[model samples]
Target: MSRYEVDKALWDVYRDASAAKQYRRDPVGFLAPRDLSDEEREALAARDVRRLVALGSHPFLTYNFALRLAGGFSMPFVQDYVGQLQGLVVGDITT
Candidate 1:
């Protein structure tokens, strides 16, 4: 059941080419966190794949926002989510 919903939401979200539009290269707008269902969280946890692969597929916005967060930006609720998502990919300088 969890996997079903995860697959469904991922497919639904990814199938749209417009998902990229949300990034817009605006660090403020792009790195905001968002609510997620259990499936969504689990899906992200299961893989390091970029959720915004349909977007510009770059990490600059995420990386910059992470630096700001580390420097003590007051993150909105959405930023928390973005942090988690970005953390999945950004932690390994060794890689």
Candidate 2:
């Protein structure tokens, strides 16, 4: 499956409060049941935002997930996402 597909599946889980709770409680446990590749699993486990962005994960969903993972709306999380997005867009433009 494509990275986008993998990200969408993850996003689906995050979008649900119960599931997101479960995931936050034990990310590895939550992902253990899914048929994700090692890279995907690692990225989620590590909360590697850059890798997720590189994988074409939805930006808004990623931002939301980051906010949730951080336990609330946080400036650092927002800045991190904005930086990543700027990099992505700038790279696209330069290329």
Highest lDDT scorer = 2
Q: Across residues 1-95, which tens digit of lDDT does each residue of candidate 1 receive? A: 23333333334334433433343233233323434444445333333234532122234433442333344355563476465565453332210
- Each prediction's total of clashing residue pairs, residues at least 3 apart in sequence or on different chains, is 2, 0
Instruction: List, residue by residue over 31-63, the lDDT tens digit for candidate 2.
Output: 886777788778777887777666666666666
Which runs of model 2 end up more than 4 angstroms from their true locations?
A: 84-86, 89-95
Give residue 39's error in model 2 in angstroms.
Answer: 0.4
Clash list (residue pairs), candidate 1: 33-78, 33-79
Q: How much is the lDDT of residue 44 in candidate 2?
A: 76
Compared with the true structure, the alpha-carbon lDDT of candidate 1 equals 0.38
Q: List the residue pairs that clash in candidate 2.
A: none
Q: Least lDDT summed over 10 consecutive residues: which range in candidate 2? A: 86-95
Q: Give residue 71's error in model 1 in angstroms.
A: 30
Query: Top model by TM-score, which number?
Result: 2
